[model samples]
Target: MSTPLLSLRGLLKRFGETVALDRLDLDVPSGEFLALLGGSGSGKSTLLRMVAGFEAPDAGQVLFDGRDLAGVPPHARPLNMMFQSYALFPHLTVSGNVAYGLRREGVPRAERDRRVAGALAMVGLEGFDRRLPHRLSGGQRQRVALARALVKRPRLLLLDEPLGALDAGLRERTGFELRALQRETGAAFIMVTHDQGEALALADRVAVLEQGRLVQLGPPRAVYERPATRFVASFLGGANVLEGQPDGAGGLDCPTLGGTLRPAGPLPPATTACALRPERIALRPGASGTNTAAGIIEEVAFRGDDSLLLVRMPGGAVLRVGHAEEDGAPPPRGSTVQLAWEAAAVVPLLG
Candidate 1:
């Protein structure tokens, strides 16, 4: 394999008693769209800033294109960052903002104009380059910020919650546009986001970070289907975590449910968590199903296309279920209901 486009070696940072990054290491292949995924305060943003030269690492070395980043200023590095808050200049027009970086670099007028036009076009804002920041919509302003970053043609693009400000409908549209734009440019994009769905949809690989470390890194499907840790499983998507013991039968012995459930993964005797995705648990009770629990309906929220039912299982386990074919079948609050899940649907977490 060739050398990675960017590499971090023993990256360490600190603030008072807090260790922002603890001997962290990461590598980004050329043209790879990798997402640094985690909840708030997971240190993903700190690592990204260190790579962008905004924060100095206390111990580790940062390398871009095999060159050491020691003493290389942010302006000198082949990198650009787009913050969650577009940070557009209210006084500058779209074209003026996009041309700011090129102007500082002393690029000739003709070349700057050509690059600016191309960048704006790439982000679908070609004809609107003359609009002020206030005149443009939330999505358009974000595109302008992206155009400004692309005008410099940096090798690495660091996006921190790039679509955070947009509404839900606009966010979905921008996600597709951004993915296509990245593919067209082939820039190694490393996005730091708390939205697990965004990362799964956009990134070729996702690094799930915890307190201050990478808990798991893999393809979206792999990470979702087989999370290395219990935290990863529950964080990426909602899961019903059941505390149970392994029975001699290839299933879990749930004393609360008084039944055995299909094993999600090979579980140890000391396993404390059983991860079963909401979708995997069926609403219609199965006769031969290995696991079944009696619960009372606690809450029923009817979303547009589906219904979200919160069932309070025996022993106080609140299991969330999504039903697709509910025709106003309201299980009255406190009414008893049977919850059944396939024996093979449960994955055990023993760590």
Candidate 2:
């Protein structure tokens, strides 16, 4: 196989007593959209900064297209980083802002003009060259920042919470726009975000970090459907983690639910817990099938397309369930309902 466009080998960073990155390893192929996802102090931003040359690791290597990045400054590196704030200069026009990097590099006037124009057009800002940053909307400002970064034609692009500044509706629309822009440019896009929805929607693959360690990395659906650990299962959302011991009868001896549950497939010998997504559960009037349980609805929340229900299991465990509203309304709070799920929907998780 060909070498990855970018590679991180045993990367480590520390700040006195705190470890920012703990020997993390990653690779990015050409034109791939990868998101670094984690909560605060999980090293997502730190890792991105190290790659962009804003920070250096104490150990290991950062390789860009098979070349070492040590001793390279941010401007000298073959990449551009767009900050969370969009980092646009209020005094500069859109064209001027896009051309700033080129001017710093001493590019000739005519060549800079051509590249700036092309970059603006690429980001759907063709006719807004003369507009200043203050005059542009949030989305427009984001586009200007992107155009500025892309005008240099970098081999890699780094985005730090690119859509965090936009409202919900605009963020959703811009997420697709950013994905499309990355595809069009064919540059490997590495983005750092704390928003789970943004990572799931925008990234081709997601790297989930936790407390300075790499927790899980895979395709969005794979990571969500088959979480590697309890942290991942809970952190990525929509999962009901149940702690139990093997019943030695092709199922789990879950004390919390006061029963046994057979997982979809054979589990690892050491497996002690499992995750079941709320949407995978089917609610009905009676519990007569395998993996069935009786629970009282503790809370009901309507979420437009679905209703999120918190159910109190017979053994006192609160299991969250997301039931689709297409068929009918969810049972009212305090109603006893039977929850059933297929074994296949259960994912065995590590401690």
Which candidate ranks first by lDDT, i.e. highest? 2
Model 2 residue 196 CA deviation in Å: 1.4
- Over the stretch 1-351, how does candidate 1's per-residue lDDT look in tens digits? 788999999888888889888888889998989999888888999998898899999997999878999888988899999988988999999999999999999999999999999999899887987789999988899999999998898889999999889888888899988889889888999999878888999999999888778788888888887676778877888776666776765676766555666675466666656777877766654434456777788998877787778888766678887766554565767777777776567777744
Cα shift from native, residue 51, model 1 (Å) = 0.9
Model 1's TM-score against the true structure = 0.93
Candidate 2 TM-score, C-alpha based: 0.98
The lDDT of model 1 is: 0.83
Query: Taking the tens digit of each residue's C-alpha lDDT, what string does model 2 give over 1-351?
Result: 999999999999999999999999999999999999888999999999999998999999999989999999998999999999988888999999999999999999999999999998988999999999999999999999999999999889999999999999999998998999999989989999888988998899999999889999999999998899998998898588898888787788788876677887787787898898889888977667579998899999998999999999977788999989886989899999999888988889876
Per-model lDDT: 0.83, 0.91
Give the candidate number with the greatest TM-score.
2
lDDT minimum window of 10 residues, candidate 2: 281-290
Q: What is the lDDT of residue 25 in candidate 1?
A: 82
